[model samples]
Target: MKLYYSRGACSLAAHIALYEAGLAFRAEPVDLKAKTLAGGADFRQVNPLGYVPVLELDGGERLTEVGVVLQYIADQKPETSLAPPAGTMPRYRLMQWLAFISSELHKTFSPLFAPHTPEDYKPVIRERLAQRLAYMNQQLAASSFLMGEQFTVADAYLFVVLNWAGVMNLDLTPYAHLQSFQKRVGARPGVQRALQAEGLLGS
Candidate 1:
């Protein structure tokens, strides 16, 4: 497998997923702003959406989207239990959290990264993020991860998106549980490896 990623992008989640699964994979850096891959290949051809977090499977099948890619990697190594077994309640619940992050938390922050985002929109976005984060904190208060004591794919996705707090200058001081979540997820060997590989960490 090969993962195309840009430093600190959501692709970091996918990169970490592969590592956590003990999967052998190659990292191909993408210049997201330039829309070019490591080999000078037009990234548009790899993923017309021109986004980071594209994974090329061993058979040459390409997977785009972080949520899907993380799930795929987890499914590849079920023993890792990054996601619960398919067709089970735990699996569906994991999917539920993934969908929530993708639609609510992830897309909600999109405007904050936009060059033309209106000044007035910032507070509205921050409010929504805070509300969603509060709900998450309450839900996670009883468990170590979003799904419970076990670390799962949902944690990875949430951790990656939540890391954007710095990008948006959203202080996390008030979210204690969420802050703990960050520390827990960051301490994982695989996540640390991913961060180091992305140049976001040092050995």
Candidate 2:
């Protein structure tokens, strides 16, 4: 498998999952802004949407979307337990968290990153983000991870999204549980490897 990704993007979640699953795969860095690969080939040919986290299988089939890519990786190595078994309530709970992270928390951060986003609307976005973060903080307060003690793929997704707080200059001081969650997830061997592979961490 080959993963096309932009450093520090949502794709990092899948990258971390791959490492956690002990999967063998190659990493292909993408220039998202240019829609080009390291070799300067058109990335649009791979995914016309021109986004990262496109996972190409050995047979050349490709998977898109962070949530889908993550689940695919986890399913590949079920013993790793990166995700719960399918059709089970625990699996549905994982999906619930994935949907919340993708729609609620992830989409809310989009406007803040846009240069054309109105200055007045920025605070409104931040406030909305805070509300979401507060809810997550409460959820995390009850468990070591999003799905209780097990560090499922949902945790990987949340960690990557929360990482945006720093880039956006959004203070995370109020989210103490999230701060500690970051530290806990960051300390994982697989996550550290993923971070270093993407140059987000020093080797």
Candidate 3:
């Protein structure tokens, strides 16, 4: 299997999942802005949408979307328990969190990253993100992971999104639980490996 990723992008979640699942895979870096791969091949040919986090399976099947890719990686190694078994309530709950992170938290950050966004409107986006993070902090106050004590694909996805707070200058000091959550998750071996591979962390 191979994962096409852009450093620190949402694809980081999928990359982390691959390691956490103890799966063997190759990581290929993408130049998202240039719509090219590390080999200078046109990435649009890989995915016309020109997005990162496209997973190409060993069989040549391809998967897109961070949530789907994360779940796919987890399913490949059920013993790793990166995600709950399908058709269970716990799995549904995990899906709920993934949806929430993608639609509510992830998309909200997009406007802030856009250079075309009006400066005055940036605060509005930040405020929405703060509210979302506060809600997450409250949820996390009750458990070690998004799905209680067991880590899931949802946690991986959320961690990657939360990481953007630094790039956006959105202070998370007020969200005590979240601040600690970041540290705890960041310390995980698989996550550390993923970050290091992406050059986001020192070896």
Candidate 4:
């Protein structure tokens, strides 16, 4: 498999999952702004949406969307338990967390990243993000991860999105649990490998 990704983007979740699953795959860096690959080929040909986290399987099929791509990676190595078994309540819980992270948390950060976004409106987005983060802080207070002790793909997704807090300059010191959660997840071997691979951390 080949994963097309932009460093530190939501795609990092899938990259971490791949390493955690011990899967053999190649990572292709994408210039999201230019919509080009390292070789300067049009990335639009890979995913017309011009986003990262497009996974090309060996047979040449491609998967898009961070949540879907993440689950696909986890399902590939069930013994690794990156995700729960399908059709189970635990799996549904994982999906719930994924949906919340994608729609509630991830989308909320989009406006702040947009250059055209009005400065006055950014505080509103930040406030909304704070509320979501507060809720997550409470949830995480009860468990080591979004799904209790097991570090499922949901944790990977959450960790990546929370990382954007630094880029947005949103202070998270108030959320002590979250701060610790970041440290815990960041210390994982697979996550460290993924970070180094994307140049987010020193080798």
Candidate 5:
């Protein structure tokens, strides 16, 4: 498989999932702003939506979206237990966490990154986003990860979004549990590999 990604974007979650699953894959950087590949080809040729985290399977089939792509990588190597077995209660919990991260956490950060967002409304948006993070902190206070001790794909997705706090200047100092959670996930070898691959970490 080949993963097309933009540095430190949500695609990093999928990249980390591939590594955590011990899958052999290559990565190509995408110029998201230009909507072009390193080879100068229009990214729309790969996905008309012009987004990163596009996984091209060996058979030429492509998969998009961070949630689906993370699950696909985990299912590829079930023994790795990157995710729970499909159709099971634990699997549903994993999906639940993924949905929450995508819709609640990820989407909330989108407006903060947009230049057109009104200055006065930015604080309100930040406050709402903080509320969500505080809830996550409460959840983590009871367990090592989102799903107890197991580090599932949900953690990968959440970690990627949490990393955005530093970039967006969203102070997380108030959520100690969440802060420690970030350190724990960052120390994982698989996550380190993904960060280095995307040039977001030092060798």
Candidate 6:
């Protein structure tokens, strides 16, 4: 499998999942802004949407979307314990957290990264993110990870998105539980490997 990604983008979440699952895959860096691959190939041809985190399987099947990609990787090695067992209550709960993070927390943070983003709208988006994060903190306060003591794919996705809090200047210090949660996730070996690969660890 080849995972095309832009460093530190949402793609990192899927990349981390691959690492945690102990899956064999190749990484292809994408120039998201230029819409080119590392080989200078037109990226739009690989993914018409020109988005990063495009996973091309050996047989030519492709997968996008960070949340979905993480699940796919987890399923590749279910015994690795990256995801809860399928068709179980924990799996459904994990899906709920994934959707919450992807749709509510992750998408809400997207506009802040846009060069064309309007300054007037940042505060509105920031407040909404704060509310969502508060909910996450509450959920995490009672569990080691999104699904509990085990570190699953959901934690990987949440860690990637929450890392952006620094760029947005979001004051997570107010949410003690959440800040601690980020620290725990960041310290994981797979998380460290993913960030190091993306050249984001030292800075």
Per-model TM-score, in order, reads 0.96, 0.98, 0.98, 0.98, 0.98, 0.97
Pairs that clash in candidate 1: none
Candidate 3, residues 1-203, lDDT tens digits: the string is 99999999999999999999999999999999999988899999999999979999988999999889988999999998898999999999999999999999999999987789999998889889989999999999988889999988899999999999998889999999888888989999999999999999942
What is candidate 3's local distance difference test score? Answer: 0.93
Candidate 2 lDDT: 0.95
TM-score of 1: 0.96
Candidate 5 residue spans exceeding 4 A from truth: none
Worst 10 residues of 3 by lDDT: 194-203
Residues 53-172 of candidate 1 have per-residue lDDT tens digits of: 899988999988788888999999999999999899999999999999999999988889888999998899999999998898888788889988999888988998999998788988
lDDT of 4 at 47: 99
lDDT of 6 by residue, 77-164 (tens): 9998888888998899889888988899989999999999999999999999989988888988887788878999888888889889
Q: Which ten residues in a row have the lowest lDDT in candidate 1?
A: 194-203
Name the better of 3 and 4 by lDDT: 4
Instruction: Rate residue 17 of model 1 by lDDT.
Output: 91
Looking at model 4, report the run of 10 residues with the lowest lDDT sum.
194-203
Residue range with the least summed lDDT across 10 consecutive positions in model 5: 194-203
lDDT of 5 at 87: 96
The C-alpha RMSD of each candidate to the native structure, in angstroms, is 1.4, 1.1, 1.1, 1.0, 1.2, 1.0
**lDDT, candidates in the order shown:** 0.90, 0.95, 0.93, 0.95, 0.94, 0.89
Q: Write the per-residue lDDT of candidate 4 for residues 1-203, one digit (tens) a residue.
A: 99999999999999999999999999999999999999999999999999979999999999999999999999999999999999999999999999999999999999998989999999999999999999999998978898999999999999999999998899999999999999999999999999999999842
Candidate 2: stretches off by over 4 Å: none
Q: What are the runs in model 4 whose C-alpha is more than 4 Å off?
A: none
Tens-digit lDDT track for model 2 on 1-203? 99999999999999999999999999999998899999999999999999979999999999999889999999999999999999999999999999999999999998987889999999999999999999999888978899999999999999999999999999999989999999999999999999999999842
lDDT by residue for model 5 (1-203), tens: 99999999999999999999999999989999999999999999999999979999999999999899999999999999899999999999999999999999999999988889999999998999989999999999988899999999999999999999999988999999999999999999999989988888852
